[model samples]
Target chain A: MDFLRRLFGGKDNSSSSAQEAKKRLQIVLINDRTDISPQLLENLRAEMIAVLTKYMDIDEPRIEMDRGHDESAVALIANIPVLRIKRGAGGTLEDRFEDNPDDRSEGKFSPRGEPPRNQNIKSRRRK
Target chain B: MGARVIVITSGKGGVGKTTSTANIAVSLAKAGKRVVAVDTDIGLRNLDMVMGLESRVVYNFIDVIEKNCKLNQALVRDKRVENLYLLPAAQTRTKDAVSPTQMSELCDQLRPDFDFVLLDCPAGIEGGFKNAAAGADEALVVTTPEVPAVRDADRIIGMLESMGKSPIRLVINRFRAMMVQNNEMLSQEDILDVLSIKLIGIVPEDDSVIKATNRGEPLTFTQNSPAALAYANIAARILGENVPLLQLDSYHSKGFVASLKKMLGF
Candidate 1:
């Protein structure tokens, strides 16, 4: 009976096996909870890059979303660089700027010594 | 005494939820506890087959719920073990045919008769899962060492917690100790870390399980199978016995590999 008891006994293995099991379990569950496939995330990042490029210049652009340890929902982090134009006198103070310089200055241009008409356009757009 | 209703659920299909339910109920019954295993998998009823009581089910849970038969009439007693019964699900009806309120009421009525009421929940977090969970006081989440099963187990555990259920236990089923030793599989501690639930049992993959199921008999009745002994250990734990969890290292060290390598070449 001792032989049978030893054969069926529950002895402790190294904790390494248990640790590996835990790692595999966590990775699979994280994917399952969000329903966001790895392929989908890659596609979403590409689309987000396209959308951001339409409005601003992003440096080392990256979009990362993950689930927090305790939180039940997905958390998002988006890194985007806003376009900043330095004005210089070349043609009309606008020709020296990048493409669509008017688009950038239209939203938030400080009229310290600028023309009144340009200030009027800015204020009207804000309203 | 009132029966303790436990729902054995695995959001992913075929993670041994029904098998665990059948074996656990059988183990409990063998220990002299009045147990009833209920199949809530409506259209895909297989708990009866696992328990080896398919031919004995004259009336199912639906028949009792619809008042077509008394609750006692729907319960199929197991000839293998005394004080053990099965309330099989209807293979013809879908999950929508029964409501959660009716399930809860049925369990309430069965509580006074049995010591443990095990509900074999269906796969997925759908209507069938909800109805099975509704009548359960506690839950036993079964998952394999694989990623998908563990993921679904986590989701089910979260749902059970949200329902204000306490004492939820995790059963890591179909574990291969050799593969785990070779660092190819997940271990029980790893699963507990991810699910963060109390560890109840770890069932090693045994070929006897297939043979037992084919014969419509639960493995817990077999004395030779390690998986059978594990089920009995789980039942003992449920009866408030402090049984130590099974360890794989000691068993493997004494195997032929170590002994043969110690001897001279033939």
Candidate 2:
């Protein structure tokens, strides 16, 4: 048991030392290729989320900015939700008329009708 | 017999291409063979510095090509070793100063006088690199254990293959055995697995290397330095001597019994 402990312990120490060297090299190369630092990547991530929020309803938790294999490029991936009018909500008087069975004979909902409230909420969330 | 021209190149910068060229050139020269090491980096030449002949360069490679001086005028003889010469690159001129035809012609001229002509190529796959590799009969790809360097080396190998060059050898430099033992650094096996080329030499990171370079001396001059010894062994290997790869870990590590006592509660 003593012999085994000594042998394995030596192996473990050497293995860890090698690991540290590898980590240092990987980090140094990543920083060398990309002018952006780790802190900058975090700041960029925050700013990216803010900009993406202005256009559409996004699942904030799902948004990610990843470094490329070359370390010279950045990738922005976001899940944006498209906004559309709700079937029934507080809208223009035309929407009430459109909802009426009698108005069914006419074409789709009138342009004056308010867009869906849920969509309005989504857009307002962006603000 | 005509000398074989081999260019050591890497697409990525700081991957020890110049160092490999210098060491290999010194190794070949030590074997009593006439060898010439050419620095093709032009504006950013480091081969002369690595070979400890930077100050001795009176006429640059550009002078030879432009007919400003004779080839012998540009060649700098090493005082430490006989039959070893350095053809330095011009610090004032850029890569565009030399063409592939001129480089090929230059190598052809040197072939009759020397047993080996090693070209120290510059970083990047540009005009300078093309010029350095144009007339080479073979190539030595130098790369670190890192992924990016390995990738760049792979691209260089591909380019050499496209140029119909064969029997290219791979030299893995700045290897840390401790890191490899810890599973942190890429092993020689890993690099060979990716490159799939004949292994020529594996050089460990030695502090003596920096010290030797700082003094403008190649490591091969110092018998006490392991790095120098490694270079000597590589030179022997190049001369068809089967020298075993230096096991750095085993040399540095304490005995197994001592390590075992430390592991136990004793």
Candidate 3:
């Protein structure tokens, strides 16, 4: 019966009202806990795109920003689709990048330890 | 030790604050502890009706605060349960009738005379809520297993925490076990996870509660009802007793098993 239900895409674990309510509440509480409004998030996304567009040609429409909370901390995560890196668009950062050798060592440019910075933006808000 | 003043509050109305207050007060008084249940819902008071002492309320707490009557004169002693008293709210007055300082002083006056002071707070996070919570050392926030109720409960819990109320606990009322089993309703664990408070009790969805309410008798007066047993366990827990939770699932298992056996023709 379980196998048949799964194959037919019938009512399963994820379809319960309890699960739906839990998901909705988890989202609502993330906002409630952080006191961050959807408008604020939208503005933050706009500002973030403005900052990122100067260095790279990003797919602005596909950009996404969200807040997440877990056991130890709340975080702001962003996903920006980069079309191409604009070389020599800003000369000052290029000059600093050439001068600072320690910024490239062991991927210390990103505070996130293991994951490379190219994939996403993760900034811890609170611990 | 002095009395522990606990305010029973839920930001949303009709989640069984009066019922829990009445039942827990009766349970505590029946255990030979001096207990008083103060109805802080000034304009729309219902604790007197739930406790079946509406006819005995000659004076209310406002009368005591206003110097119209003495404190003991305003307290209506429960005839059904000894050592239980009710400081009923005035039906004609507004929530602004009782200030926080007056409520706290009333609590101080009742503390030395009783072992438990249970303030039945009104709905909403307004003046009535602040007035009721002002006197409480601890709190028991009541909520049903619904989204709005849980959300309001979270708001109340946050306000109570900001007020420096210690040992705030939860009372999840009208919990439908069959609905929870069928994944149609939120479980107590789910509510506790969202509210993040220590659970003091979970009262099952029992029809006897309504019958008792309409008849002006609290469920704790009965011996074996599911809600009665749950309220008794809650009262015991308030007194620092380590009683286990009442098996709410067992309240419906008999009917469930009988139906299953009938369907199987066993």
Number of the top TM-score candidate: 3
Candidate 3 TM-score versus the reference: 0.73
Which residue window of length 10 is worst by lDDT in model 2 chain A? A118-127
lDDT of 2 by residue, B38-143 (tens): 9999899888888878788899988998999999999999989889999999999988987899999999999999999999998999898999999898888888
lDDT of 3 by residue, B112-228 (tens): 999999999999999999999999999999999998898888788888988999999999999877778778888887887877889999887888899998999998988468789
Expressed as tens digits, the lDDT of each residue in B1-266 for candidate 1 is 79999999989999899889999998898889999999999999999998888878799999988899999999998887799999999999999998999999989989999999999999999999999999999988999988778888888887888786667898889988777776668767667777778988988888888999899888888755778877888888888899988665544565664553233111
- C-alpha DockQ for predicted model 1: 0.24
**Which candidate do you rate higher for TM-score, 1 or 2?**
1
- lDDT by residue for model 2 (A3-118), tens: 89677775443435334444444444433433445576577666555444433446667555555543232333434454533444455545667568444344333223334232
Pairs with backbone N, CA or C atoms under 3 Å apart (clashes), candidate 2 = A6-B260, A15-B182, A18-B178, A18-B179, A85-A116, A86-A116
Cα error, candidate 2, residue B20 (Å):
1.9
Better of 1 and 3 by lDDT: 3
Candidate lDDT scores, in order, read 0.78, 0.74, 0.84
Q: Model 2: residues >4 Å from true position, as ranges?
A: A1-127, B247-266
Q: Judged by lDDT, which candidate is best?
A: 3
Scored against the native two-chain complex, candidate 2 gets a DockQ of 0.11
